[model samples]
Target: MGVQVWTWILVGITFAIYFGIAIWARAGSTKDFYVAGGGVSPLANGLATAADWMSAASFISMAGIISFSGYDGSVYLMGWTGGYVLLALLLAPYLRKFGKFTVPDFIGDRYYSNTARTVAVICALIVSFTYVAGQMRGVGIVFSQFLQVDITLGVIIGMAVVLVFAFLGGMKGITYTQVAQYCVLIFAFMVPAIFISFQMTGSPIPQIGMGGKVEDGAYLLDKLDQLHTQLGFKAYTSGSKSTWDVFAITLALMVGTAGLPHVIVRFFTVPKVKDARKSAGLALLFIAILYTTAPAIAVFSRTNLIETVSNTAYKNMPQWFRNWENTGLIAWTDKNNDGKIQYVNGAALEGKTPMFLSERGEHGQRVISNSSTGPNELYVDRDIMVLANPEIAKLPDWVIALVAAGGLAAALSTAAGLLLVISTSVSHDLIKKQLRPDISDKAELKIARISIVVAIIVAGIFGIYPPGFVAAVVALAFGLAAASFFPAIILGIFDKRMNKEGAVAGMVVGTVLMLFYMVRFKTGLVGVLDPLPESEWWFGTSPEGFGTVAMLVNVVIAVVISRVTPAPPASVQDIVENIRIPSGAGQASTH
Candidate 1:
């Protein structure tokens, strides 16, 4: 069968499976909708959480970023994976021990203030919506490219899929669906990577192939280092970033990962605190499988890309080149009319005379076009690397189809999880707790489904009109979560003296600071901080790394303000004490 036929077949099978699971696991009560009746096994919850956390950002964009950025991209790999350590050690077990249905519930009860809870609800909504918009956009991108549908229609289809499962089954349905998604996405990601690894290094293991010797008798890392240095770029294994920026970015991601409402809420599905801790460990193992393979894929794809295009004539380029160019991902312009493509570090031209582009090389520059007078320029979008990998590696058409399915699986699983959090926060925290205390469980469940539908519509609209690149939006979401939620939750758990006033003030200040910096640096709000000139960065840290500083500001402000204010009431302190001890896990009640 043709690739399109196989793609449709795979998609049809996936849809049928997900819908069947949704019907079989339909939630009948508010508790089931909110937390899967609070009886999920650790291993199952871990698999579900892995599926929910990976998202399109991990499966699609991460390897691409690493491919282009080289060693600098390691920060993302380390930061994202390392954050789980913090989550397992400091956050998950305590939150699970607290036995709350929502993150806001813990804040409200622990602080003994409804104001604190309301603030958390608002923060959760902001972070979840911002993050979900990117996931929805990813789903649309995958559908548009592989399914041959318009982006808007793709987004609507994706929304329908999420709503069918999430609205009917809630957490109960979403959990099992995510488990299946995890299997599909992992298999899809690994197959092409393993094939490419063997083709490049005669090793079937991707992680080892990353640093292994190439077929040409050169170490892979050494060759990458040589290529980077020749192109006036940094080495592939080391970085030139400032220590403070690294520290800050790492810290921000750690806190943000722990504070993500969707991720944290997954722990609530497990029956006990011990299960939560065990589930966290399992979740990390699942995530590590992709995390370890991703760097290998990055290195392999980068090497393949550079080697394939470096000296080849534009007319003789592979079909994959034209295919990606049609997607607007790779473009070529000839300057000296030599008909060959030239790829180099654009940043190397800064502060130095453009001898290559402005003049001719010793070998005489090759220009593929008569319209330009300089050397040829190559532009490759990072987003295309992973999606185009199978074609580049000459893998089977079925593998490409599987990748498309995997991309959708990653996006849909996370979208369902985020939607559940958004719905529960609305129906349980806002409606049941604040709006209508007398609301019945049936009424709450109905409202949860309605909220899921509404959330899907909002997310779909944003998906069609995504604000920026996928990774950039994801970083912003993490920054917001780190600034607003991490401080409150950490202080609430560890410090007995942290008060509602301190937590609220810290979150507001941190969130505002992060927004201001991101707008100024990333979105061009200020003329003084334009994209040109390497000196434009604040302390040489990119906007993506600014979240770390924001997180610190939050922690410091919260601590300082807490000292100035009265401590929490004795009852609140007792609740904190109870949460710290695991023995009373069964007795800890959700509001």
Candidate 2:
């Protein structure tokens, strides 16, 4: 069979497996829909959480970002993974001990304010919707590349699949399907990295292979550093960002990971607090498998890409290059009519000359005018690196097919998790708790399904018209989560004196300030506000990293408000104490 046929076959098989799990685990009640009846095993929950957390960003975009950004990309690696540590150590156990079906449930009951819960619902929707939009786009990109479908059509198909699983199975079905997804995605990610590592450095482990010597006996990191320095780019292993910016981005991601409502909700599915903690450890372990391999994949692919295109003619470019070019991700402009493509630093230092300088020196002047003449520029979309890796490395067609399926799995799993959070917040928190307390469970389930459909449509629209900065947009979502939800939840858990006034004030102020800053810098508002130079960033933190600052502001505001106002009642203090101890796990109060 041809590659396309095999790709479809693999995708079909994955859908069948997911659909089967959804049907087999079909949720029968509100409890099932909300938290999988609160009986999921630690291992299963861990796998499901891994699937939920990975998303399209992790599977498709992360390595690509790392590949282009080099050492600077480690911020993503450390930020995302480290955030999970915060979640496991500080948040998950306590939240699971509270034994609520949804995040808003914890917020509402803990704060003793329905308004607080509603605000949380709104925040969850915004964060999840923004994040899911990117996932849907990722699915579309994968489908357009592998299945030869139009991007819009791919998004629609992906949306349909997600609706079936998420709306039909709810949490119960999504959980089991996610476990399967975790398996497929991890295998797909590792197989190519392993192959490339062995081929380039004679090492089976890609992580070690990244720093290991190349066939020419030079260290890969050292060689990449040399290439980047020659090209007038920062060294591969060093960073160009200010220390404060790095710290802010890392802190934002870490808090955002801890604050993400969808990720936090996963712990509620497990049976006990201890199980939640164990699942956290397991989730990180599964995540680390891909996270560690990702850097290696980035380094390997970057090396392979530079080596292949550095001196090759456009006509000599590989099939994968041409294929990706058709996607408009890779473009070549032949400036001087030289058949050979020249890959060099577009800008070189003035006085400090290099062996290879582009037509333009450090200044905006052209230097080497296509001495040979070829494409002046090559633009390769970062998303293509991982999806096209197997083909680039000349791996088996089955491996390519597996990657397609894995990408879909990663996208769909995260979409399902996000949809569940949105739906539960709407049906359980907004509707049942506030709007219609007397509604039947069956009716609530219907409303949850309706919410899922609506959320899916909204997310699909975003996939079609993706924001200009996909990575930064996703980071912003994390930042918002960190700023608004993380502080509220952490305070609610750890601080007995925290009052509803403080929580509500913190969430509103933090969320609003973060949104304002994001809109001002990230969107068209920058033109109106007058753009701020990179050097003028607040506290030297980039807009992308401003979530940490916003979060700190939230904490400060919350503490001040709590101190000024009255503290939580003694009953609330007792409740906090009860949540801290695991011995009362079985009889834990839902409130």
Candidate 3:
């Protein structure tokens, strides 16, 4: 069967399932809209949360990044999964006990200040918006290939589908829909990994196969490291990033993952505080299924790509190679014009670089040249690794179609969750709490639905005309969350004396500082300033690593400011103590 036919069939089936879930799980009240009636089973909530947490980046782009970054990529693995440990132990259960419908609601009530809540809402919007744009891009990439439409139209179609499900069902619908999506995406992700593992190492399990010896008796990592060095790249088993920077990036990602409002909101859907904890554990397990296999996939794909494509002539390349090259993501320049492609470290090559060209070959391949005449002759976008993996391995057409469906599932599930956060923050935290406290439940729910539509449109715009600094901004979203929300939420829980002034100041300062660092380094927002180099870094902290510094600043400032101010009132202190005790947990309260 043709790729389009298979894609349409599989994608159509998944869409039908999602739309059915949306109709069946439609919210009947504000409680249903916001927290799915707070009666979700722990097992089910875990699946839904997994779907929400594993965005397109996790399913599609992560392994690709890992493949090229080698050991340095461990930061993503440790940081993302490690954050779940903190969520399970530090945040989820206590937040569930607090029984608020959203993260901002908890901040408002906990600190006894609308200003604190407002700050939190702004942070939530920024984080969720930045993250969702990436997911939108993922959605567009899949649909653009599957439906044969331009990326802009693909994004619009994706937005329309998400609108129907989210606007109609709210959290009630999105939760159940995510459960279905989790199953689809995980299955889609694993099949290719298992196939590649068996093909390469004769073992069905990717994890064990990764370590198992192949035909030559050398372990897979050893082979990869050997090949990597031969090609002038860093050894695959060793890291290139500095230790302090890796630690800082990992720490920032961990805290940022915990601080994200969309993931935190999942706990609010469970029946009890205990269920929230149990659900976090299950979600981690579900996520780990993919996370553990990803490194294996990365090693396999990297080895295969290097062996197959490096030094091969363009005319003799495989169809999958040619197919991807047509997408403009995979490009090669005959820099030496020897008619053989050289894929090596560009920095290490000697000579002036060949000029880049807009011309195309008869095969429709881009006429690329060396960025400089280093050993480099090719540019492969890391984002294409997973999506191109099945084809790279010469897997069946149906499996490729399934991967397309999986990408959409990963992108759509997270997009819905983030949009929910955006809409709820606007309607529940900003409008209902501040502007119209006495608004009818019906009116507030209506506004929330409208907010979802508006948020989707705004998110789509960001995706379509993304900025040059989007990559940094996306990472900075987590940094911003880590720096701002993590400290405030933690201090609010553990310290009864944490006053509103301290919390507000910490959030504001942390968010602003992180933004300043990101905009200055990544964008022209600073206006023609010379690029900051590694030598100028504060204690070797890169912009990506600065979140940890900002987080510490928030903690220290909040602590110092709280000490100088009056303590929190007795009633608020009592509520804090009550939250620490897990018993008598109730459903999420709108009031």
Candidate 4:
């Protein structure tokens, strides 16, 4: 079968499995919706957690970012992997021991104030919505490139699929379905990597193949370094970012992972503190499988892209080039009228992405109105690198189709998790806990389902008109989580003296500050205006790194306010003490 046919078959089969799981495990009560009745075994939770953690950013965009950024991209690998460790070690078990359904649940009950809970809820919404935008956009990219749909139509289809599962199964359905998704996604990612590895380096293992020699008897890295410098780009293994900026971005991603409400709530599904710890360990192992392979994939894909397209004639370009051009993710213009693609180290267009003209050139290549005056005439969106790699390498139709399915799985799994967080925050945190304390379980469940519908609509809009690349947008979400939730959650648990006033003040200021930086710099108000240049970066730190500064500011404000204000009540202090105690953790009051 052809690539599209195989894509339809694989995607159809995988999606069917997800839908079946959603119906089979559909939530019957508020408990099932919130945390799968808090009876999930550690192994199941581990697979679900791994699936939840490795989103579209990890599966679709992480390697893509590395492909473009080279050594500067190592920060993503270090920061994300390290952050999971920080969260698993410092937060997950304690949060699970507290027996709360969500992060806001813990904050509200612990801080002894609905106001503080309200702040956490708002922060969670901002973070989850921002993160889910990337997932939905990933879905759109896969559909546009592989399934040959318009990006808008693709996002709408993605929204419908997510809403069905999230509305039906809630956490119960999401968890079990994610296990199946993890299997599909990992297999999809690895098969391509292994094939490309053996094709180039005669090794089946991508990690080793990255370091091994090619047919020319030269090491892969050495050949890539030669290719990079020859093309006016920096050495592939050398770093270009300032040391402090790298540190700040890394720290931001690390803490952001720890504070993400969707990821943290995974622990709440487990029955005991020990189960949370066990799942955390198991999740780390599973996540490493992809994380470790990402850098190698980045190297292989980057090498192949440059060798295949650089200085290649438009007419002679591979079939994959024209296919991607139809999606507008990759474009070329006959700059200098040379009829050749110049994939050098400069922007190919005046804007971030290409603006394709309605007309075709003499050589039948799509014309781009936004072509720049620079020597480079090729525009390739970074998000397409991973999806296009298998095709670029001339892999089998089944392999390419599998990648499309995997990208969708990676995206949908995380989208379902994030939408669930958004819904539960509104229903469980705002409605049940704060608004209508007497609301029955049935009504709360219905409200939760409704909330998912609304949140997915908003998320679909963001996906349709995204502010940045998948990983870049996701990085901003991490920064927001770091600035807003990290300090409050950490101090609330560790500093029993921390009071509502302190946590509330810290959350408000940190979130606002992070928002200010992101708006001024990263998003440009969803294209209402142009973003400020890198020259205007604050203290040489990019928006992704500003979260570290904001987080520090939050810590200072929280600590200072806590010291001046009255200590948390004796009962609140004791609740903290009991949660930290290992022996009684399983028996602690969930209220």
TM-score per candidate, chains pooled? 0.91, 0.92, 0.94, 0.98
Tens-place lDDT digits, model 1, residues 243-306: 8777777677777888999999999999988999999999999999999999999988887788
- Once fitted onto the true fold, the runs of candidate 1 whose alpha carbons sit more than 4 angstroms away are 335-337, 347-376, 524-534, 584-591
Off by over 4 Å in 4: 526-528, 584-591
Model 1 residue 57 lDDT?
83
lDDT of 1: 0.83
lDDT (C-alpha) at residue 246 in model 2: 87
Where model 2 places Cα greater than 4 Å from the true spot, the runs are 346-376, 525-536, 584-591
Model 3 error, position 32 (Å)? 1.1
Please rank every candidate by lDDT, starting with the best.
4, 3, 2, 1
What lDDT would each prediction earn against the true structure?
A: 0.83, 0.85, 0.87, 0.94
Q: Write the per-residue lDDT of candidate 4 for residues 223-250, one digit (tens) a residue.
A: 9999999999999999999999999999
Q: lDDT: which is higher, 1 or 4?
A: 4
Task: Write one digit per residue (lDDT tens) for candidate 3, span 1-591.
Answer: 977799999999999999999999999888899999999999999999999999987887788788988888888899889998999999999999999999999999999999999999999998899888888888877777666777788889889989988998999999999999999999999999999999999999999999988888889999999999999888999887889999999999899999999999999999988899999999999999999999998998998899888888877888878766655557776657677778886541222222436786554445654455556777776777888888888899899999999999999999999999999999999999999999999999999999999999999997786542223445667788898899999999999999999999999999988877766664434346745656777878877778999999999999999999999899999999999965556758777
lDDT of 2 by residue, 1-591 (tens): 766888999999999999999899999999999899999999999999999999888988899889888878889999999999999999999999898888889999998889999999988988998788889889898889888888899999999999988987899999999999999999988988898899989999998899899878999999988887775667888888888888999999999999999999999999878899999999999999999999999888887888788757776787877676555455554454466655665521221111223343332223332233223344466777888888878888888888999999999999999989989999999999999999999999999999999989998998987764356667888999998999999999989999999999999999998887877676545336644566656777877799999999999999999999988888888889888766656796879
In every candidate, how many clashes are there? 3, 13, 2, 0
The weakest ten consecutive residues by lDDT in model 4 span 522-531
Tell me the RMSD of model 1 versus the true structure: 5.4
Worst-scoring 10-residue span by lDDT in model 2: 347-356
